[model samples]
Target: MPFTVQYAVPMTCEDCTKSIKKALDNVEGVENVDFDLEKKLVTIRGESAPSQIVSAMRGIGRDAIVRGSGRPNSAAVCILENAQGKTRGLVRFIEDEEHQIIIDCTVAPTTPQAQQVSIHASGDMSQGAMSTGEKLYTLGMTSKFGDVFSLITRQSLPLMNTIGRSVVVGPPSGPTTESLAGVIARSAGLWENDKVVCSCTGMTLWEERKVATTV
Candidate 1:
């Protein structure tokens, strides 16, 4: 299970988040972390008991208090990997009913060249705009939690649309003989004519196939 911790600290910069993350990273059994500066919230994952987490946070010189017992909704985590099963990067989609989902980028343990990300959707994205139809809005790496939260509340895009929109993820290396074959296997030629859209470098055919299947 996941949990959240709220703290009352003077964290005026990213450096503060980084410092807290570094401190938490030193604790054993921690798995993942997501910190928001404006909300002053930190979500952490671990297999250990909650008491241990509370103690660890206290050791970091912050007044930490448990805030929630579960992972936040509409948060989708994409784990990118290379041919040898090495991690590459993370692409997270945070959705809300008021605005388009925001995407966040983070480096994974392994980076691949020529990597592609496929997005599968069931509903039409054309209702918003021509480009908006196929292009799902995702927060850029530089996105801040406060900014994204504001956008979500202002626009009113249903969070459920993300699950229904036809998965349009890609950046598959053009229509090469081998890459085409992989797409055929996964998308059944639905994306045969679509252009590769990902910006990852050095991604291999196997990785592309894997991404196609996953998306």
Candidate 2:
């Protein structure tokens, strides 16, 4: 259901309203924001937790209260790992119209090179991504300095298939040879050594869409 959550925020002028609006704008799943200066009420309509909205308000040096009902949506999460299966980051996955998926993660830099993130076959990070063969699909590249990765794909496949799968972020493939090891090596530039995933949204963000709708 489309839900509305109101907050008692501190606002004294247009600038405050603007600041509040800007802060609220970054929150995911937010649909609409309205305010009543007289009551100091900030009404938000969306699907995300009210706590997120409240936290956004606090981010701008304002305090807020959840003046109404708020609930969380369905989500999947994973811990990103390196080729040796060491923890590297966290990944959160959400849906894009049920046919697509958005992977959002705060990753620690695992390599000196730019990293490519992709959905793979195996969920086990121990085998690293070697077990998770095939690109399945590539989300995109993350910078070398541990940046936020927002990879989106309009998947014709099912989300359930991704459940036991893996999201690997690693350096682009290196040189390839005709050797058997090389055959298993890059998998045609789709595989790399520094691949990592953490313990895990895009296209148009869920925050940018109608909150009531879900995949």
Candidate 3:
């Protein structure tokens, strides 16, 4: 199913937009692309993976940050981190209008082997994955590609119920203290987030992006 995903791109001229459109045209599964030059936002309607879209944008020497996806109140995100607070991966959940949940996950520096990914009952992360409660739902296993473990699958999990839970990635046996875990949080829907500056930090989008990428 086709869903909308929005990105914040730095564009200074119509030529930049043309470049982006031209690059995205080669990405499979992309249905359409729309741009807001003044806002430097690009909204894409497609079935393409978010990572693929970002890579496409980067192919033209432009960086893209995903601003929103899916529909209002139907999307959520989790940043899996180890006990040391080092980010290990990111997971995005999008429930389409048909109620089919799209799970997109990416983990780096993982062994070139399959590993279990699931949601736990508790969101507590004081002790990392070990502290998260019982496993509630097993999304699936991730397949390794190069140095990253990536998985893009469609399931039937409800988005709302997963909020406040914890998603964990670990060995096939089960989660451990060394496993990666993160609390699920609600994310903005397509076009729901349009602020150029973060009110809390008074930092521009690019500034925030700098901090995020550094981390």
RMSD of each: 15.9, 14.0, 3.9
- For model 3, residues 170-200, the per-residue Cα lDDT tens digits are 8867887778899999987666768767889
TM-score of 3: 0.73
Clashes (backbone N, CA, C under 3 Å), per candidate, total 34, 15, 0
Ranking by lDDT: 3, 2, 1
Residue 99: error of model 1 in Å? 32
Question: For model 1, how does the per-residue alpha-carbon lDDT over 60-137 read when each residue is reduced to its tens digit?
Answer: 655443333232354444443333334333333443222334332333212133223334332333321112234344
Model 3 worst lDDT window (10 residues): 206-215
Output the number of the TM-score-best candidate: 3
Name the candidate, 1 or 3, with the larger lDDT value.
3
- Model 2 lDDT per residue over 1-215, tens place: 34554555656788899999888788889999887775566766666554466557768877553332232232355665554444556554443233333344445544445566666665544455565666665656664321332232223445445666666666456211210000111010101111121122232222222111111
Each model's TM-score, in the order given? 0.29, 0.47, 0.73
Residue 115, model 3, lDDT:
76
- Candidate that would win on lDDT: 3
- For candidate 2, the per-residue lDDT at 186 reads 9
What lDDT does the true structure give each of the candidates?
0.37, 0.48, 0.79
Q: Which 10-residue span in candidate 1 carries the lowest summed lDDT?
A: 180-189
